[model samples]
Target: MNNQLPPPPAQMMQLITGFWTSCCVYSAAKLNIADHLKDKPQTAHQLAEATHSDAPSLYRVLRALSSVGVFKENEDHQFELTSLGNTLQTDAPGSMKAMAIAQLGDHYNAWGNLVYSIKTGHIAFDNIEGMSVWKYYEMHPEEGVNFIKAMSGLTGAVIQHVLPEYDFTSFNTIVDVGGGNGALLVAVLDKAPQAKGIVFDEEYVVAETKKLIAKKGFSSRCETAAGSFFEFIPENADAYLMKMVLHDWNDEQCLQILNNCNKAMKAGSKLLVLDSVIPEGNEPHPGKFMDINMLAMTGGRERTEKEFASLFSNAGLKLARVIPTHSPMFSIVEAIKE
Candidate 1:
């Protein structure tokens, strides 16, 4: 087993051409190819007819994705879903279909202007789209719903790893601040049956969240609140959970949110912030790249432990500990209200 790095030019070429794979996967996802292939193997011609696409062009995409292990090509040119491909199924657990569309659709233009953001220190999405991502979603409700589904998909992927690492059973009440669609809170409440929850977010978002809560048959134990985290949060929950929330803001905005959480928190309560805590030094990490995505789209960032500690202190909370999960992409940054 060799531990040496690949030659620089070869590695750089792979890095530069990474988008080829992304675009191919996006095409597959957009066309619902994975869902079509889920029950049985199908030739690209069959898939093309089902998707209303050109057979030859669709075959090329399936062939490309097959090389990357997203699908498998057989002797007769039939394509079948690999385990990786199954994740792109719309109804699959932790589905990435919506995420694929979003990243390649709405987020594509903003990411293309990343150089502009780098040069001017402005949000590329706002510069390119002429509105904040949130407002853009509001004006485009279909896209907004897809975006929410994308977030829920992402949360679904990570929650399995998170629940085992942290205990939610102790809290009698949990508030998921900026909880989109109540997925995380619902999962937590399932584990902590003694705990009731509130899914707190903007008015538009919580409307859908309420329906989800009722659908999950948790309507009595969990409720939805419509409001912004900047102005107010529901007061005095035993625990507040913010998963992938603070990473969408800059330091000043983060402080405002933290402060609001502080004001709403009762003494001896805990705030569990689930986000990527970028470690120090040059070891490769997903958060390092996600940090760039933040810069390009939201003017936000992934924080280091030191950064989180400082942010917590500024909001008058004590950084209790940073708990690692099975996945390195996230950590539980636990803080306490004294």
Candidate 2:
């Protein structure tokens, strides 16, 4: 005696249209359409003319995005920014413009060959560039800069969440082991006046952090060191922090990095890993998708609480606590050297 049947399944069409949506988003980013409409609405014709794209085709793309809430289809073929669409505006404080462009840019091609990674367990970047992503980036500085910019922009939101949760007051010295441009290093130093800081990474990355250190007028207290975390790290710091670093590698690589941190630390020194912990079971979390992205890209993973603790224990350390923040998207897992 059922009165109605369930709605038709939207899964297949949604999955099939994912690329179309990505291309739509990419087109908007490339044309600066989001930036153009940040302050006001624009008609399809106006946007097409401004971006020099085909009016009809561009309108179709915009319409499709409007259907998905990236933009609004106001009356008279005009488009206005939706809340979700504002993330693509570069001038916005917490902009994801760079992330969108990068995801939909060179990486998109690599992702197209996801089956290659799935079948072979080798990186698609290696297939594309005849080398790993790091090597390719090292050989191409322009691309490397874009890669860094994309990472920095993506991490900005997460770091803003992390800034308040942890108490940085107690430690006099904090070392960002894999700190990229010293953004978090600068943030920590500014908040904790008593803390001296060291921003450590490869030469190319840490070199630029010096300018930031200079800008912060902590030139004397804050310094940059060039090194690799795998081989060894600058030792004897009161505390060490790595943000969004470990998930870029497999468990063995993660253990190597953590062991390096442990070797460099005295008893009671802290190691902070800022990353997403893949919660157990099918409970639904963004990290599950990210875990797959890691698998496809670097053969890495977004780990769970137990996985994190095991990694810490493997490195001759113990899990101190899993500190949650306002942003459930990331957490700080603290481990102390044995």
lDDT of 2 by residue, 4-80 (tens): 74455666667667788888898888889898898889988999899998999889989989999999988777899
Clashes of each: 0, 0
For candidate 1, lDDT tens digit of each residue in 1-338? 99998999989999999999999999998899989988999999999999999999998988999999999999988998899999999999889899999999999999999999999999999999999998999899888889888888888877778767888889999999999889899999999999999999989789888999999999999999999999999998999999999999999999999999999999999999999999899999999988999999999999999999999999999999999988778899999999
Please identify model 2 stretches exceeding 4 Å from their true place.
1-8
lDDT of each: 0.93, 0.84
For candidate 2, give the lDDT of residue 314.
90
TM-score of each: 0.97, 0.91
By TM-score, the best candidate is 1
- In candidate 2, position 51 carries an lDDT of 92
Model 2: how large is the Cα RMSD against the reference? 2.7
Residue pairs clashing in model 2 are none
CA error at residue 20 for candidate 1, angstroms: 0.7
